[model samples]
Target: MTLRPIRLLAGAALSLALASCGTTYSMPGIADETNSRASTMFAEAKTAAPRSPISESAGVNRFARVARRIEPVARQLCETELAQGKAVDCDVKLELDREMQQRNAYFTYAEAGNRSPVIRFSVPLLQDTGNDDEVAFIMGHEYGHLIGRHIQKGQQQAIAGALILGVITAAASAQGGGYYDQTAVENSMELGAMVGQRAYSQTYELESDMLGTRISHAAGYDPVKGAQFFARDEAARSGGGQLSFWGTHPPDEKRMAMVLATMEQIQGQQALTRKASQ
Candidate 1:
């Protein structure tokens, strides 16, 4: 078999596979004005004094309150936005990770029975939040993951990437008229999986932020203020030195800009609705 044919086939398959994954919803476009404002805000956050962490009890109470409001809004949005006939689980469960020391939150399916979708917030992350809006915004962001079907897409991408790379590696090894190099193909597959899984990572984050803005606003929270949670120059690791929130959700001016742009879109939509009603 010619290496060129195998390479071409692998490339075509890879493109097709990756193209099948990604966001189902459109992301908001960032205007120059919003970008400038986000830059200023990001700069200001760096110099701003750190606020005191809320007491653990206060944080828990705040989380409970925010969850009560955000959960329904998120579920409704998920159900409304998801295409009809899709089987995505809109009933997302909210949980507090009391045992975790890191400041972080994540959305994932439960490992055991039924595999229900769950969003978990660490106690430290809750205490670190500045307000109820921040809590609501973060929760909504996690909900975005579910609505976007990021986890599922990521899994698909990983499999595609691995297969494509493995095929290419095997073909290249065979080009020498030698036995298949299993070790080389396996190593390449592992690398491919990692690369593919992260291919849309940034885009996914922005998509989540965009959806998060709408969800937070519907829950009656200021998303721009809530997004300030990302502006600070805080450690990505927890006090215990484990990777935490900032590690995964790195601080980026573009994210702030995306949130601002999304809010603008939301406001414009609301105004149009009001005018239509009038």
Candidate 2:
């Protein structure tokens, strides 16, 4: 009986997956960068809050530690996606910008032709978050981007958008037998870039969340508590648990639901494994 439901769900998912794969676009650039932006961030950034009472330094250190631990696990997760016996030849560098320049964390490929990934944390993010679990989840999510190569995919999408728009602009100019406005070409490229970056952005966020749930749990952190950070942030901003979609990110409530659902799936799998072992 249980197998019947599982099969039905799997079939439905496969059908949807097939339908979505009908159209495709490609990006034109090296998917990774070797440049390091850490120095600039450290040199010019400053914290937004006072340091004495909150011990912002300590918070920053803790953030670094959590990020360091999560990086290797994320790499291992990436490895699982590769063909048998393949490996990634790089380390993940964890850094913090104490200046609180932005309450954000992100992953990027190292410049200089090295594939080593870098994860940076903003001090304000560490200070603003309530606990280690939240930080871990956030780190894992960023790490997911690195492992999943979303940066490269995003660049590809952007380039494809620009090329398409450029072609259209050129064709239009040719039809008029006159020079295309330089400003018009630039504007089209900018618009294409904007669209490219945002294409399937919400889907990417959800994918990262799915990976983050597993990564955080594997690292011994509770994703449920980590997900509370979203709830808290939403409540603070909107004054209620209002659900609304944001560009480039899913709504807090939807993300929360994804996390919880992922947790449930993990638990279910573990239970099945245990039963089989008995």
Candidate 3:
């Protein structure tokens, strides 16, 4: 579910998968750099997040730890939401690729943009996990996509993404194609096109967090683990939480408060149910 260089590579195909969306943010001379990023992310996902020996690079192994915490929550969301009555299949991975710099994470829905999606974490931006909440939260966020059927929802986002890239491309054409303008086009593609979709994207994120809490709590991981990821005070003003405005994310404190509030709600319901059982 890792995003690739082509998505951000200035030109790629998205007609087949959610991965087909070409990047408007890629500058002319930097396609190779983006490819390196794509390669690195794929390598990391194959090695780190799997349950076996991480034969790939080990620098980003921390994200894999978080991905492990994510599996149960992801499966539960799919089972409950889709009524599949079976384990939800998912692959959660992380990478240090910079092409996905604008995307702290994403739900790459399916092969035909139809099946269960994989969750990609931007390794460049991810903090190493110690308590394991960030992974749970991220998994929850992606599982929320499954609950909300974000693959189908992503069709709408695709239009928004494409349009964003189109406008920037037009702007670049008008500006005589200087390297500076080209770079502007790329940023515009990400910030203008992809960023505008932040409202729904952020909504998906928060919804995932809520659902993740339920899944994690049920599975025995502290639901608060996911929320604590958003508690970093420094990054929140610039970056915290997901599926919201593009200034990075919600304020760290605000996200933590929201997660805690959600937890309390979940706990209250669980307590009520237990009392009734008694």
Candidate 4:
């Protein structure tokens, strides 16, 4: 029997509380250690890639110029969410990584003793990206993840799922007067966590894309071109099969469609604002 609908509703309710809670950056622990490891990896990758430093590359300079313009705008939006109690205050840091070949970017919570969230852009992505709008859109998307607190929400949801499954496993075993071995309990909990992680994966991606559309537009970039990147990627993945049911992200085509929808919404809102101003 499918319990997904019920599970989704419960998870959503729990997420409200989880998402609203603020983060504490006091002592170092696993999270801090993980952050340190990632930073070290980025640093090491720089030397390993053998590319000119981002500071010395003209293309990267152009990328940085656009990033500088969008950073403050993105932070202001994040601050607005904080003021409205939608999120905890988080400093936003944009860094360029000139070593990784992958065209990728990510947002992570700040290291211990630091309250700022960090966004890293791979050098190849910066160099190969179509234009300024694409870069701004990508940065804004990472900011969207930060303000939305998706990472924290995902962790909380996973723990909730694990706990719920653990209880169910014990109760079911007791009712049936059957053995519930520790191994079975552990396996159930692990499976629950895996399910929980996938629960909001697509939703988070779409919401971030929507928020990113508004953000990039507000930062004076055309979101249409921002969306082209996905369509281009989708074309490249044409031979790939449909996204798996257990996947943690929406398919590229779905993401492209979402970007288009979000762009339309933003444009409509802007038109209304312009009309109201006159």
Candidate 5:
């Protein structure tokens, strides 16, 4: 459901305490779709697809290595470019034994969404062949979440949804003299919330892809080459029948296009030794 539906439910009471609440989605159809577009885009650039990385416990170390390489650059980029002159006050911690056995690296603010915002990566490298570029790119992807401010924005969206929902319900009951159509009210509220949420959450990914590109470039890594990892994987998994490339992420083709466009802009700056001040 979209976030707009949630907000409508909250209705006009958002002035109050709005605080509250709240892929690859790579099932069968998902992968095949990614493969077609991601594959073509990468192939045109002569970028070879990568085999699936190992998925065992041994792989975490590999993921960690990649995260380490990119963390410095990602943090620096945020502080210098995205943070708007705010200092980045956070830490990166590695684990040799995680009880939950999570397969992915994650980003968590040290402040826990309160004050000192921090983004942490918590996965080891792939257990398969240790491709640092791919691993770093993976790390870059998680870090991309923070650069995009998905964390805080996500919280705000949730609260907005909840606030709208509560207000809508309360107001409907009051206006209807304690008699309201439950189904109609529910359907309307849900639809509105979904629209609002999607607009805020889903659309930011392309911009994040662009931001990630700038990050990879600044870190002294090959953003173009690093992107090849996603390009190759997206195409292979997308197989040949998937429909939307952005089943979860930015569509493979769209992401490729954005990254390329961003590359052109940055390379021009590099040639001129241009430095970003904000």
Candidate 6:
């Protein structure tokens, strides 16, 4: 194939891949006022004294309480989205991770049996939370990942990226000779996949935060307080050098700003609803 055709094919593949990924809901824009407030909050959190870790029993109790409240609310939201014709799985299983030492939580599909979606919170991470609001927020955020179908979208992006890059590499190699360099094409595909996965990760995190805010608020938890968990200056990796919660959910002023903006938006929506009801 000619270079022009090869370029066109790669562009088409990339466009298709990108079309599959991204937030279904509108992401709130950060206003200047919200950004300033978030900056202040972030700065204050960095200087604030570290919260003492709770005992295992206390942690477990807090988790149970928060989970009890947040789960139903999250599920209801998921069901609503499904009813709106969103291709999302509303059935979510919340589980505690007893083995991992790192402070982290995640949502993923179970490897065995039916690929059921499960959200797991590590024991250490639970113990590290300052309050139930923090726990509720974290749980809500994980639920956002499910509602947003981020994992599924990410898989599509990776496949598209790999395909696009692989094709480009193969076509380039075939330009001089009729043969393509298999190893080079494979390497390019791997690189492209990594890029695709990482590219929208920050955006995904913010999207989750927005959804989490709504879920937590509906569940009667204070999302602003819950989001303070992100303000802390924590290490990205654990003692063993593995990626921890901070590694995945990096603390950022923009995230705090997004939360603030989302909360304002929610309040505005509530006011409108109340006015209409009256």
**Tens digits of lDDT, candidate 5, 88-132:** 443444333343322334555554655554433333224423355
Model 4, 68-139: lDDT tens per residue? Answer: 778888788778877886655567777876665555678876678755678887665665555688777877
Estimate the Cα RMSD of every predicted model relative to the unseen true structure. 2.3, 14.7, 15.6, 12.6, 8.8, 2.3
Q: Model 3 off-target regions past 4 Å?
A: 1-66, 84-103, 110-116, 124-127, 157-199, 234-247, 252-254
lDDT of 3: 0.49
* Highest lDDT against the true fold, candidate: 6
Candidates in order have lDDT scores of 0.85, 0.61, 0.49, 0.62, 0.52, 0.85
Between 2 and 4, whose lDDT is larger?
A: 4
Give lDDT tens digits, candidate 1, residues 62-169: 999999999888999888755676669987889998888878999999999999999999988888787888888899899999988899888878878887888888
TM-score versus the correct structure, for each prediction = 0.92, 0.69, 0.50, 0.72, 0.60, 0.93
For each candidate, how many residue pairs have backbone atoms clashing (under 3 Å)? 0, 8, 9, 0, 47, 0
Better by TM-score, candidate 5 or 4: 4
User: Which lDDT value does model 1 have at 53?
Assistant: 73
Cα lDDT of model 2 by residue, 105-216, tens digit:
6777667676678877767566656578988898887766765567766776676565555555655665677776778767876786677666766767777787788888
Model 2 TM-score?
Answer: 0.69
Residue 245 CA error for candidate 2 (Å)? 16
Q: Ten residues in a row with the worst lDDT in model 4?
A: 237-246
